[model samples]
Target: MIVSRSPVGEIATALAANGLILRGGFNFCDDEAAPAAGSAAPAKSVLLVGQAGAAPWPHFQRWLERQSARIVNPLDTWSCEVIGAVAQEFGARAVSPSDRPYLPFQQWAMRAEGVKPSPLGILMHPQYGLWHAYRGALLFEEEVSLPEAHAANHLCDTCVERPCLKSCPVDAYSGQGFAHEACLDHVRGPRGAPCRSGGCLDRSACPYGAEYRYPADVQAFHMAAFAAL
Candidate 1:
C-alpha cells in the first residue's frame, strides 16, 4: 500500500489482465483548499482506467468491489460520488456544476489542488478522443507525493482545419466557448438523431484518435448524461 515509487506500470499491467486499460493516476492532498475538506491527511492516489466497451465497465466494477483495498470511490460511481463522499467524511460538501450551476466547475476543477483532469480530455489522443467520459476515480487511504500540474495540451491548438469546431451542424462550440443550451436542445430535440446514433459530430470529426473512438453506445450514454444535466 505504501507505494514509494511509481506503481503506475504495475497497476496498468493488472488492469490489462482484467481487460481494462490504465489511463493515468493522480494524487490529491488533504490540506489543500479543496471544495470538500476533511479528506485523509497527507495525500491519496487515484487511478483512472478505461474499457474498450460498456461490458468491461461492469466487469471492472465487480472486480474493484471485490478488492480488499480501500476505494474512496468505487468504479461504478461517478466523480461526484467520490467528491461528495470525501466531503462528507471531512464534514464538508462537494461543489460541482450540477450542485452549483452558476459556478464554473470546469475552471474550478482545473485550479483545484490535487485534481488533474487528463490532457487527453482536451486533446485527441491516439486512442480516445473527446468521446470518452471520466467514469469514476479510485481513492487510496495513504498519502503520496505528486508532481506539479501541467498545462492541458489541447489538440485544437495545432489543428489547421479545426474540424471539431465546425463539425457540429448546430455550431454548439464557437471556439471561444460552448453554447450549452444550444447543445442540450439539439441533443434532446429532433436534431439529435445523427449525434444520438453515431456520436457527437464535432467530437467524432476530430481527426485525432480515430482508432480509440468510444463505441457508439458509450458515446450516446455520455451524451445523454450531458443532456440530462
Candidate 2:
C-alpha cells in the first residue's frame, strides 16, 4: 500500500497541533543520512522539530507521563512515537537524539538555522535564547528544496558584561569549559538551593529573550534533571 507524500505546510500544521515547531530543515546532495535498514535510498533531507519555550509542554509532558507510565525510556519513546507517526504519515524516516550513533543535531542545527552554542553549551537561539530544544528530526528520501540558512546575529558577541561567565556560583562555565564535577557536586549539595529552585543563574542572566524564560517550575524540572546527571 502506497501513501501520499505530505506537503511541508501540512506537516508543519500537524506538528503545531502537538505544540512542536518545525524549526528548520535542509536538503543534502550527497545524503548526510545513511540508509535505514532494508532501504536502498538514503535520506535526502531533514526537518528539525522542537519546542520553543515552556508552556503546553508542561501540560503535554504531564499528559505524556500518564500515558508513558509503563515505558522505560519515556522521552525517547514518546519522541519516536510522535515523530515516527508523522514520518510514517508523510513518507519520511524519524530519528531522535536517543538514536544510537546519535544524529548530529548540533551540526544540523548550526547548518540549518545558523545556531551557535552559548556559554552553557546549549544552542543559543536568537529569539528563544537557551530555552529552546530540538526534540527530533524527520528524514525524507525525496530531495526537498531547502530554505536559505539563517544568519543568526551573535547576541553574545556584543554584550560587554558577559554575565553568563560570572553568574555561576561554582564558576562551572568559562574558558576552561564546563566544570562538570563542580557543577554536579554543588547542585547535589545544600548550597545549590537557589539554583535548584530557580534554574542556572548563568543561563538566566542572559538579557536576550527574557520574555521566553521558562517559569520557575519548568526551570526546576530541568535543574533536577541536570542534578540527576
Candidate 3:
C-alpha cells in the first residue's frame, strides 16, 4: 500500500486529497552521514504535514498504517517522549531555543543546519506563518531522491505590515531574531496571563493560514517546554 516513487510530487498530491497539506519534503542518502552522525539509519525521506482541524493525530497514524508507511515515532511518540529519548541517547540536554515555543528535534535540526525558520518551515509559502508545527516525520526504507534544499522564500520580504514582529506584547521577536529569555519570563511569570491562556501573541498575529494554527493544548505543551528550558 505504501506507494514508493522518486517524485515526491505524486505523494504530495495524494496527501493533499486526503486533507493533509505537504508543508515540506526532503531526502537523505545512506552513503552520506547524517548532519548529526548517529547509529540510526539515515533518513531517506521526510514529509511534514499540516493536519490542523482536519484530523486527530490517531486518525493520521491509522491512515499511515494503512498506507504501510514507516513513521519515525508515530502518533504514540509524543513530543516529550521523543525529546526525552533523543536526549538520553545523544547525551545532549533538550533546550528550547525558539521565542514562540519548543519545536521538535527535526525542526531544530533544520535551524541547526542554517535553515531559516519561516511560516511552517516552507520558505516560499505565504500561508501557515509559523502557526503550524511538525506533527511527526515518516522515514521509508527504500531510497527516495528529492530536490536539493534551496534558499527560503520568506513572505517577510513582501509584507508591508510585518505584523508578526510588531504584534508581540513582549517584543519577543524582531529582525535581529528571537529573544528567548524574555519570551519565557513573559510566558511563565505574572505578565504571561494573556499569552498563557490565549496563546502566543506573535504567532497569532500572523495573517497567513490563520485556520492552520496548532490546537490550544498543543500550543500550551510547547510553551511549557520553552519555559522549562
Candidate 4:
C-alpha cells in the first residue's frame, strides 16, 4: 500500500500532541555510514524526536496511570509506541536510542542540533541546557526538508564557576570521565536521600537552563530509576 507523505509541519504537530518535538533532521548521503531503518535500503533522512525539559512528564504520567501491569522502562516503552505509531502514519521507520545494536544517537544529536557536552557530560543546549532529552527518531525513505542546524552559543565556555563539577558528593564527573560506580554507590546508599528524592546535584548545579529544569516529581522518578541500576 502506498502511503502519502506527511508534511514536516504535520509530523511535528502530531508529535507535539504527545509533548515530543522535532529536535532536527538530516538527509543521509549515499556514502554515509548511517544505520539501516529495519529495511533492506538505508533511510534517505532522519528526523529526531525529543522533549525539552518536563514537557513529556505529564503525558508520561497519564500513560503510566493507565497501565494494568508493572512496566519495565516505561518511558522507553512509551517513546517506542508513540514514535512507532507516528512513523507508521508517515510511512517511516521508528528507532530508539535504547535499541539493541545501538544507533549513534549522540552523534546524530550533535549533527542535528550542534549541541556539545557539558562538564557533567549531558549535552548542554544554549536554551534548554541539561533539561532536554532525545526520545526517539523517525527514518524516512524520502528526504524530508529540514532547517539548517547552526551552532548555538556554547554556554560552558564563559561560565567561570563550573559548579557542576563541584556539586557532586562523590565527584562522579571529573576531568577523567564519569565515575559511574561512585555515582551509583552514592545514589543507592543511605546518604543519597537528597539525590534520590530530587535529582543529581551535579546536574542541578548547572546554571544555564534553570528555568527549563525538570520538576521535582519528574526528577524523582528519574532518580528512582537511576538508583535501581
Clashing pairs in 4: none
State every prediction's TM-score relative to the real structure.
Answer: 0.58, 0.89, 0.55, 0.95
Error of 4 at 138 (Å): 0.5
Predicted structure 4: lDDT: 0.88
Report the C-alpha displacement of residue 134, candidate 2, in angstroms.
Answer: 0.4
RMSD (CA, Å), each prediction: 7.8, 3.1, 9.3, 2.4
Cα lDDT tens digits, model 4, 83-199, are 999999987899999999999998899999999888877898999989999999999877777777888788999999989989988999998999998999999998888998889
Regions of candidate 1 where Cα sits further than 4 Å from its true position = 1-10, 26-31, 34-44, 51-123, 143-154
Better of 2 and 4 by TM-score: 4
Write one digit per residue (lDDT tens) for candidate 3, span 125-183: 33455554444333444345555555555666667876767767778876567787888
Give Cα distance to truth, residue 113, candidate 3, Å. Answer: 16
Error of 3 at 144 (Å): 2.4
Superposed Cα deviation of residue 14, candidate 3 (Å)? 11
Q: What is the lDDT of residue 218 in candidate 2?
A: 76
Q: What is the C-alpha lDDT of each candidate?
A: 0.52, 0.78, 0.51, 0.88
Number of clashes recorded per candidate: 3, 0, 1, 0
The lowest-lDDT stretch of 10 consecutive residues in candidate 3 is 90-99
Tell me the RMSD of model 1 versus the true structure: 7.8
* Residue 65 in model 3: lDDT: 65
